[model samples]
Target: MPIQASFPSQEPLGLNADLIRKYNQPAPRYTSYPTALKFKPIEDKASRSAMLADIEDAEGPLSLYVHVPYCRSLCWFCGCAKIISTNTALADKYLDYLEMEVRRYANLIRSGRKVVQLHFGGGSPNFLSPAQIGRLDNILRSSFEFDPSAEISVELDPRTLSKSQVLAFRKLGVNRASIGVQDINSKVQEAIHRIQPTETNIKTISWLREAGINSINVDLIYGLPHQTESSFNQTLDEVLGYDPNRLAVFSYAHVPWSKPAQKILERSPLPTADSKIDILIQTVQRLTGSGYAHVGMDHFAKIDDPMVKAQEAKTLQRNFQGYSLHADVEICAFGMSAISQSKNSFRQNQKDLDAYYKMLDEGDIPLEKGYLLTPDDQIRREVIMRLMCDLELDFQARGESNGVDFQNYFSSELDRLQVFEEDGLISFVEGGLEVTPLGRLLIRNVASRFDAYLGDAKQGFSKAI
Candidate 1:
């Protein structure tokens, strides 16, 4: 069935300028509690094999994440693990190694394990040839049985996406897609080095819909260079015309130290901190006012979309992909720099392509780093995920489930929140604390309070605002 959607009346959010200014310092996006920055290097494959064995015995449903780290060229503001190249031979070689890696895991996982979700994400997943995408899909399907309700999705750059590729996605049973159109303003696109015209994106969505791919997501970046309030409003209007089922409005993280390409943006006239806040306010007003439900931080979905349903049902989950609906499925990631997650641990593949290929050639998993969640890590992760997804926390219920007083356990964190509470971004209710609408945009700051690894506060994380 096509994913249905609706948006109820919009709630007025308090845009606390003062609070934003105070808390708008470097902070993690909280995709994971410890975050990948805290991942410890794994020297061998024994632990990985053991974990897979444990999972196989449990025999739960699964989610597969395949990373394609190739892009035709670099977008100056891009921070993802990506390789900017157009060499088909390079891509073909990577896929050959990827097949070996997938087969390795497939052998470890027992037969007939169901895959409920599969996602292809990267620098640009569509950079591969049509046949290449099909081959990857076939290899995965051959290894695991796909659930009838499986949701297959991909992230593609509209500038590089083509009609034949859209047809290929349909052939592979891709039901959902996210297209990148950071900004429609020519100057902004020029500054960012991603020059996709407005009509090109509209046409891409049209093609996907015509090919029976109805669940569409469009990504927009706020706080980019030359992004004024007026220009951002115009971009929002242009994007709303596409009427996407889901929207991800991300703040442009300008971490030159982490992503050297971002250094190119240094010479450009970027928006000031206050101006970025204005742009964020404008974006929220436009999207929420236009009938898009504010599902959570930087994410909006149609009221009836599965994400919204997940939120209403309190089953919403947050991972590297941001907000997601399937919480029961363990994630298995393939390709260089892909990160996989099970209930007990998070593992990452080798970030270097050469190292990844060498490990596969040596008949071993190209595992580089991972974090095995301790009992404490798991509890803290639960708290952070809840605050991020549901925007509220029931202290009593949380404590009851874990056999500890949540308030007493997290007293320091709760005490730290006094600043947010005083600033009116958050408030205490009947049994627990509630993040006000003002706190929604600053949810990362709220979630960070519970992070045990976020010491020093000097780490190179993006700003909260």
Candidate 2:
């Protein structure tokens, strides 16, 4: 199932500003269908237990998402669910509650399913000491089985990440590491209040490579305050010199309502909308020109990168933690604010630490809100994911696989897509829909057409651009 992706191999992606501005509306990232914004309050324990039963009966491995929400300090530019504290003792206590939460799930998730993928995301997973990281790993291993070659990855903050911690990560079977190099320019760093010089990232990468963990990923952000195209190109040049295995060049989403820390950034002048677009266009051109294969939606990988392999083989998937290689693996997440994704449902842990601990102390899973997938949701999920990951959708083949006439069933949606086609963002092929290079930048807008619940509901999603 080689999904046809006509994205240019090394050529710079061309941009049409008129099309970009028209489609630069707010839209879900399609990381999960029905979107996290649709999650409702869990009715009772039955709903949760039923989801756990589905996970147990499901016939595949699991993907574990361990959220360590603690951070050493505040980066005003960040919008993640993070708790700022310099107190290391708080993390040790958090771990105790985390183990209890995992145990509660383990008692209910009584199955032989193993973990094929494991990701550690956070304010910063490296906020913990080496011993704490080891303890966290031990807690997870005791509850669930992990495949021998599981794709284990962690997010690191070079400022806080230590060589000893990197060694422990390698010893504990982590093969991939992603560090944030969100504009190494001193002024940008000062604006964000996270003063990490490029030397920090270099030292961190050296430690990781020395520990035999070489699948490196670096995250870059556009649309930051005082970011010019030239300034960002300098950052890109510095990062390209490192030759990362993969790159996630994301557009900054400034949502002050959800993340109060972001309001502080108002003191700094942000790049104008036009300036942001220029930065985005040049970033795409630079990465593609430098021989990195542009994987869907802000991610770029080397031709030999596993992510590129997954995209080519049609196994690439989007999740709460962005893109993943395993589409079938159900996610069982632990820790505060962590989201758990089952075959037909999604649930998140309590976000507040006190509330999270209270639920754990009561010997219950700290479930906050969740959404169950309808049958229509399941079908649409596959359809939208194919469009998102493979960058195309085969009507005939997908019709057979999904047991519906894709053309007839989605007739109205196809009609809606015509506006994009007219705008030159997408095109209709012989038996499928293909996103043109121009459309790739606004892929969310194209994927949004297939969303059943997107009925003029503003889900507070970031702009499609």
Candidate 3:
């Protein structure tokens, strides 16, 4: 079906300076509620065994996330754990190790455990050839009881995909494809060292649709070097022309000190904060005006999109994959730097491949760091998830009913959000706090106010724009 497009005629909204001032601070992306930084490594076999036990006890279907951390070339702005290499031999070796890891995990779980979602993300999952992806898919299906209706998704770099590759992915049961279209402007693309043209993207999108893969998602960035309102508008127009099922607009996090390769983007200019804000406002207006329902922070989709349906049913969930239809699936991450979350806690694999391989070879889980959620962590996580996903927190209702007083438990945090209330970003109601539309843009900041370990922790995270 051809996607409908419309632009709202309402005047653009301006940024709330006071809200921006009070909440425009660095914060975790909240891919995990407590954030991975809080995770402490499992020091012994006993602890690891307990963690595995928790995973075994969790009910319902599982989600599998496999990280293929390799790319043919580096996009200077990328901060993911990836290796830039042309060695097909290295990829083959990695595949063997990945298969071994998958088998190891499968052995740990009980029989009849079903996988509801399987995602391949990385420097680029499409970095592997068609046969390799097919091999990986077959391995997963053999090792786990994959639900035939499961959402099998993969992230692609259009510059690397071919027609045969798209068809192969469809045959492998990939129902969704997410392509990166950070910016259509050549100057902006050149600045980020990810130079994909309009035709390349168009062809890829068309090919995916042609191959019976209809759910297309396009990713765009707002704060890249050389990204101006005009450039972004052109990019948006170009992207809308392809009519993707979903759009993810993100703010570029410039952390040169952390991701050294980002230092390479020295010559091209970045939009000013106000200009970046302008582009954001314009983009949001454009998406909504075109009839795409605003699916909360940084996501837009057709009103009938599965994600939108999930949101309306209050079953929508946010995770490392952003918004998802499978909210409660126990995620088992495999590969270097991959993160897994069970009902009780979260665990992460070693960040570096060498450390990862070393641990796996030594008959260990290769977990570098992880946190076992305390009862308090679970409570706060529930509260934060409610606030983030629903844009409202029923502290008195949710807390007191759960045997705790909302104010007493989060007194200091409530005190912190006072400035936001004063700034008209959020409001305190009878038994809950509601995030005003203006506050939605600063949801990460608002959520951070409840973080017990934000400033004290030394781990760096992306900025909340």
Candidate 4:
């Protein structure tokens, strides 16, 4: 089914400042329903082991995530789990432990379970040397049967990413590369402590394409301190000149409560919520008008990109990594703070590197927290993910399949949605619900209505805007 292309609409989201101010509140990005905030401490290693056991019997292909947590220096705006060190030797040591962790899981995963998707994400996967990248790739290939057409991808920091490293990655069969440009403005770069030159970014993209890594993605950020509309527009223009296959225009989620490094931003004049919303509006208009398809939720893709195809087909999926085209594969992640999701459970590796190493040295899974989805959690996840990805829900059909009454099962939640309905964010469509074009900008706000745990949590997450 071709994805309904009603979005990327020339029409505005109709989200005025007052409406945005009223609705802009802390909400989960819905990368996963019952977001990480709801995860409980894993009381026993056996629970994780049992999850591994299920993977052994599962018949589907796998998605492997390897987290590389080392960065040469800190990008103060970074919210990801990372360790900053100038020492290259640390990567070699980290790789040894990472290899051991992969081998440990390889023993549990069935031999024939082909890896269909492999992603290397981190503080910066580029932190590793060419030789180190080669070693990691070899270790993984030797341990698992990878599909010949597996989608192998890696995230890189363009500042330190070298052409030699890019070539090595290409030789290792990396078909996709995501580079962090963040912002090309000099002031924004200095403020964020990520001083990457525009020439470097253009060269990085050029090298990736020359290496035959055709699916290139460049990331741009809005709402950073020192970001003006003109500066951001210049950054966007510079990025567009590279003509990346995909663009991830993300809002700078300032959660100083969770990431103390972001506290530095408090000292600077960050954009107001109203201004941030304006930047978002500008982003949508620029990208969509430039012939890129808004793939929803901070992503834009060229018309022929697979992500656009997936969105059209309704097969697009969301995960901890943000958006993915591979929906059926179970993800098995290695390294500190990495999350592994299977059909029955979600598990995370220890967040502390020393603790993770200690646990793995003792021959344990190094898992710290996770959630085993209840039947109810699974059902709610379905509802949340659909509204999030497809922007529509067929309540009666979903209820029939899940063996629950559409309206009765969610009476209170539906009652809450009445406000949004009244506000024109959503409407009843074919006995179900659909997010209006005006509501697409506030999709997270719409999806949050289906969350069962939001009411009980007091922890502050990032704002929806």
Best by TM-score: 2
- In order, the Cα lDDT scores of the candidates are 0.85, 0.87, 0.81, 0.83
Q: Could you tell me which 10 consecutive residues in candidate 3 have the lowest summed lDDT?
A: 1-10
TM-score, each model?
0.95, 0.97, 0.92, 0.95
Which candidate, 3 or 4, would have the higher TM-score against the true structure? Answer: 4
For residues 302-398, what per-residue lDDT tens digits would candidate 1 score against the true structure? 8778888887666788889888887756888999999888878888999998899998999987888888788899899888988787778888877
| Candidate 4 clashes between residue pairs 3 or more apart in a chain or in different chains | 3-312
Cα displacement (Å) at residue 63, model 3? 1.0
Ranking by lDDT: 2, 1, 4, 3
Tens digits of per-residue lDDT, candidate 3, 49-163, equal: 8787877777778999999998989998888889998765677878888888888888888787798888889988878888887888887878999888989998999998888
**Global lDDT of model 2:** 0.87
Instruction: Give the per-residue lDDT digits (tens) of candidate 4, residues 259-283.
Output: 8999987777899888888787777
Q: Give me candidate 2's TM-score against the actual structure.
A: 0.97
Q: Give the higher-lDDT candidate: 1 or 4.
A: 1
Candidate 2 regions with alpha-carbon error over 4 angstroms: 1-3, 6-8
State the lDDT of candidate 2 residue by residue for 1-465, as single tens digits. Answer: 434664445863568876677777889998898798889887787887776677566667889999999899999988888999988888899999999988888877757888899999998988888899899989999998999999999999999888999998887799999999899899999999989988899999999998999999999998888899999999999999988999999989999898888898889999877788888888878888887888878998887788888887888989888889987778899999998887788888898989999988988789888888998998999888888888888888888888998889999999999898888888888888788777888898899888999979866889876
- Clash counts for all predictions: 2, 0, 6, 1
Pull out the clashing pairs in model 1: 6-303, 6-304
Report the CA-based lDDT of candidate 3 relative to the real structure.
0.81
